[model samples]
Target: MIEGALGDLRNGVSRIAHNEKIEELQSEFSGDKPHLQHSKPLHLDPMFYEALDVLHYVEPTCLAAFLKLSQFMHRVEDVPNTKAYMESDRIIKWPPNRW
Candidate 1:
């Protein structure tokens, strides 16, 4: 029961995050209109906290995977050569060390 509730909460938060991204992109392309900017730090802090809240209810492996995926997505834009890595048809190599 608690696991289900936590899953729902996670899904709700994910939807909010997705909507915020969509709005930002629309604003960027539409030009000259103000768009709601989602606070990354604010959002992330709450998200991490919420994840922690339900950590006990969730499987350790699942939680670890979720966190890893979230971290990857958050750092996607800032990583060097991200576009090249994303667009490559062949296997792309990453630096031995990343930020």
Candidate 2:
């Protein structure tokens, strides 16, 4: 459980026997943002909160859903526009550090 961030993977999980490659980082989330502007900020983009939500509760409703969602998430990372999406403030950028 990435605290449910990738819970879908668990659901879609199977005894089907297959092969896939997943890139798990040494840490669940990475990157460091340290700057003077970090002065106890009072506000953050709504997308930021949405990002956290996906990170918090993305478990699968079923095992099929889990496998499907995992492939979907993996595919999302493979899209040509992924770099752009990650840089932008879109829900697509959910799981900021993990993705």
Candidate 3:
């Protein structure tokens, strides 16, 4: 019975979180103005706290939310940036030399 109740609670919270993210994304991308110019600064403290909680508690909903948030924050690959690193004389040892 307790397990079922917890499952239901998790499902409900997940739905709410998913809906909120949808709303936020819609509002962020709907306007005619540039997203970066008008959008509010993102606060990352709560995200960090949620990540820590997920790490400690191992909750499914929190973990899913964290993963989704991480996906949203993902950046595209930069070829130029990688080129600079590749051209640099940085010696990288395979086993990393156990310290």
TM-score for each of the candidates: 0.23, 0.25, 0.22
Between candidates 1 and 2, the one scoring higher on lDDT is 1
Tens digit of per-residue lDDT, candidate 3, span 1-99: 868866765664465455646435533563433222233323442343333333334344443544434433331112345345546787342322121
Residues 57-99 of candidate 1: C-alpha lDDT, one tens digit per residue? 3443433435433443444434356446556785333221110
Q: Tens digits of per-residue lDDT for model 2 on 12-88?
A: 33212121322122011211322112322223422233332343355333324344334434434444565466567
Candidate order by decreasing lDDT: 1, 3, 2
State each model's CA lDDT, in order: 0.41, 0.35, 0.40
Ten contiguous residues minimizing lDDT sum, candidate 2? 22-31
By TM-score: ranked, best first: 2, 1, 3
Off by over 4 Å in 2: 1-65, 87-99
In angstroms, the error of model 2 at 45 is: 22
- Candidate 1 residue pairs in backbone clash: none
